[model samples]
Target: MSDQPPYTWWPAGLRRAGAALGVLGVQWYNAARTNIGATATSTVFEPFVTTALAGAAYARPFVRFAGTGTWTLGRAHFAVGDRSAELLAGASPPGEGTYGYTVTRYTNEAHKGNGLYRDLTLELVEVTNAAG
Candidate 1:
């Protein structure tokens, strides 16, 4: 009844490989803090997770192949900040604690062959919010 061809499980091997790689990838989260309630005496800040962008948000996983230095992969060259998140190194995600970071700078190196994926490098400084 449909004009499109029916889908089949072609190239099952490739699919399985991709799924396995996905399991090894790290998780990234867009960090945000919002003032839920504010009065003359006090203000309450709450952690906010969103995909929406106010300016720029670092919230995606990428394969890290090098340490905290400039390196070239294929045709991409980039550096990892010293304060980069451990999650980038395949560490487990944060626990119940909420952390805040200041984005000093962010750079993206576009791969020539694949325009869909870009190598992102971020320089972050950890900050604490006493008001939170």
Candidate 2:
């Protein structure tokens, strides 16, 4: 048998596959753009609140779109169930609140230098009382 390094093209193929896998993951995250967060003391995580208020409800079955959002003190990170999602926003634990916090969406990465992160902000205006 000829000794041609036994499949020299394996590494490249693997790399391409890995890249494709990464893209798939990111796309899944983008499409599942459901941002859910809540207070630390609270055991419930509410994603619907943001969706209803942020006008993202119509965007259900979230498309694989790149975007960015800012987080303040009262808010927590976007979480899928109990697992906090990286694609969504995160909280700074608990502390004083900030003004003018918003989360802006983007279609083109060039819009923001970060590409993935857009200049956005969010605020937690209404906090309903926990059921007794």
Candidate 3:
């Protein structure tokens, strides 16, 4: 008496197609390289907190991009998911170092297993206003 059905894992593989929407699909933009907004559906909570803590000082902005991107990361890059380049609050700065951002942490946190998909999280670091 096998508890398995006719197809055990077949139902789970269907989600990969929808998940890999940006394998060869989307192109992440690099501002310093070309001056455009792009990349994954990344998060920016820490940056926000940092900025908020600064109150009214001088702190650089942080950007986030997360989603499914087949775009390769150079020394710097992002993971984006659409054709139209949309800019975030403090993204695509005028120049690097003037107010630059970097990936402080990157993690492949989870896998849906519902498809050919894997979950990822990347933490970005940036300057924010000072308490003084």
The candidate maximizing lDDT is 1
Q: Candidate 3 at 60: error in angstroms?
A: 20
Ranking by lDDT: 1, 3, 2
Descending-TM-score candidate ranking: 1, 3, 2
User: All models: lDDT?
Assistant: 0.32, 0.24, 0.28
Q: What lDDT tens digits, residue by residue, belong to model 2 across residues 1-132?
A: 111111100112222222221111110112245543211211122222122222122112111122233222222233222222321243332222534323344343342446654433332343334342
Off by over 4 Å in 2: 1-77, 80-111, 114-118, 129-132
How would you encode candidate 3's per-residue C-alpha lDDT over 18-114 as one tens digit per residue?
Answer: 3332111112223232323222222222111110121222112222224644433322222222211222333442234564556887778445454
Name the weakest run of 10 consecutive residues (lDDT summed) in model 2: 1-10
Candidate 2 whole-model C-alpha lDDT, 0 to 1:
0.24
In candidate 2, which residue pairs clash?
77-90, 101-121, 101-122, 102-120, 102-121, 102-122, 103-121, 104-120
Clashing pairs in 1: none
Which run of 10 residues does model 1 get worst, by summed lDDT? 38-47
Please say which candidate is ahead in lDDT: 1 or 2.
1
Q: Write the per-residue lDDT of candidate 1 for residues 1-132, one digit (tens) a residue.
A: 112221111112222233221121223333452322211111101111212233222333234222243332321111222212342343333322557778998888986578965767678777777475
